[model samples]
Target: MKANRKLVAAAVGTAIAPVLVLLSPAGIASAHGYVNAPASRQAQCAQGTVSCGQIKYEPQSVEGPKGLHSCDGGNAQFAELNDNNKGWKATPVGSSVAFTWKFTARHRTSNYEYWIGNDKIATVDGGGQQPPETVTHNVDLKGHTGRQTVLAVWNIADTANAFYACIDLQVS
Candidate 1:
């Protein structure tokens, strides 16, 4: 069957290149997608620790073919995230990229563990003063170029289930 008109147009839009962000969060690291997090486990920007991720993606689109499409097609997927880390993804644009994030302790994520691609990204997990903080990083995504979606998941170190997670993807 022929593709829907809107979907075709959207696909063209993605191929042509428009600001495309998956708004998702990673892989090979036991990172679960953010949508999986329980609503009660939701982390407040002002109460939890913040980890940021920078991402880049192959040609995709915010406006792309809808309905069952291929991986190569622009997808509205919530980047997978887990308690292992927190971050944001962005496509290499004109010059630089920016990131801002926070994690709250109020979610009872006792002993929260955080990392950024193998680096310790945070100090406190779920205990202590529930610090509210922010960090900024800039990177050139001219390489590793593909759909870059940062992942952030929250779960007790010894626990199997995650409590909170989030991802912010910037596609261009």
Candidate 2:
């Protein structure tokens, strides 16, 4: 009888092991962040300023492998962000723009990069620490004028992944 009970206990543990792993943080895509101020593409979708599909619901989930240049983070659900003619509202700003980020799930970060075309405008080191709920970086947009798209990347320190946000701007 004791042997049968032990066998049942082992079976239950085996059955629930996969579920437990799924419930673990490491088992899920944990890092979530997005640029908020100046209204990034995902931000516009989340705020109803633009029409989008799945990305509209989880704007902060545009995460993929690091060193990617795509605005959607290579996520098919956020492919609308890659559409240049989607009528994404361009925020008007001066040469210096402060880009704010909102993090849903904070992770140790490596750095934040801002790019305009092939030019890297700014790179703020994260110092391998978890950031606050909201972080802002003032990026100089000098030498850039008129309509432009800024790609912002948040590279995670501990993971080989990064969060992406693309901000459209009408710079002065």
lDDT of 1 by residue, 1-172 (tens): 3569889998889876533433322122232222211111122222233331211221111112222112212333423223224332322443223333233222233443333334434433455233244323343334323433332333443334443233333335
CA-lDDT, candidates in order: 0.31, 0.93
Regions of candidate 2 where Cα sits further than 4 Å from its true position: 1-31
**Global CA lDDT of candidate 1, please?**
0.31
What local lDDT does model 2 show for residue 2?
A: 100
Give the top-scoring candidate (lDDT).
2
* Number of clashes found in candidate 1: 27
Question: What does candidate 2's lDDT look like per residue over 33-103, in tens digits?
Answer: 99999899999999999888988888999999998899999988788899999999999999889999999
